[model samples]
Target: MTLPLNPQRVSVDSISKIKELSGENIKACMQCGTCTVACPMAEEMDFFPRKVMHFSQFGMLSRMEDINSYWKCASCHSCSVRCPRGIDIAKVMESLRLLVLRTNKNYIEPSQIPKEKLKEYPGIMMVAGFRKLTS
Candidate 1:
C-alpha cells in the first residue's frame, strides 16, 4: 500500500501565522495521539486532530487543507481542552478551516454540503448560517 505524500513547498511564514493566531506552540506537540483518541470524530475523520498538528508542525499544511473533518469540528474544544501538550487544538483546527473556507468566493448552502448528517436535520448548519447572515 502507498501513502499520500504532502506537498514539499509549504511556506514557513504561513505556518508561523497559523501558530500565532491559534496561540498553539506547535513545537510543544509531541504527536502523542491522545488528542485523536479523545476526539469524538476520530473514527470518522480522514485525519485526526493530532495529524493536523503534525502536518502544521512539519510545514505540511498543504495536505491538511480541505480536510472535511475540519468543517465537522464542533469547536467543542475537546482536543484543545484535553491536549497534554496544552496546545489549543480546537483553535488550530478553526484556523485551518478559516484558511480553506476563505478560499471560496461563492456561498455554499447547508443543503449543498456533501456529507452525511448525523441528525434528522441540520439544525446547527441552519442556525449557524442564519446567525452569520443576520448579524
Candidate 2:
C-alpha cells in the first residue's frame, strides 16, 4: 500500500541538498527494511536506519531532530552491505550529521574536552572527533 504525502511536508530543496551531499538517490529507497535489520544499533535507535532513510526520502526533515537516530549509527557498513539497492546508508548518516553541524548547533563544546588528552590525539583525530561530537 502506498502512503499519502502532504505537500507542505515535502521539501525539495532539503532532499536535493541531501542527495548532493551524500551522492545518493534518496528516492531509490524502497523502504524494504533491510538496513534496519542489518543495523547493529537498531534496538537503540529511536527510528532505526531504514526509517531514517524514509524520513529523508519523504521530506520529513523536521522529524529528524526528534529521532536523531543517525547519531547512534556505528558506521559498521552492515546496512550498506545488506541494502539491495546499494544505497550508501553510512554516507546518508554522515550527510545528516553534516547538515546539522553546518547550522552551528554544537552538541559538544570545546571546553568540555580535556586539554591534555586533546594534545595527545592527532590533529585529524581531534577534528574528526569534534565533527562527530559537535554534531
**Prediction RMSDs, each to the true structure:** 5.9, 5.8
What C-alpha root-mean-square deviation, in Å, does candidate 1 show against the real structure?
Answer: 5.9
Q: Write candidate 2's Cα lDDT for 49-131 as tens digits.
A: 98899988877777776455777777899999889999999989888777777776665688888999788879997787676
Lowest summed lDDT window (length 10), candidate 1: 1-10
RMSD of 2: 5.8
Candidate 2: residue pairs that collide: none
Tens-place lDDT digits, model 1, residues 4-111: 233446668667767876777887999998888888887778788888788878767667654666656667777887788899888887666555445542234555
Best by lDDT: 2
TM-score of 1: 0.73
Full-model lDDT for every candidate: 0.67, 0.79
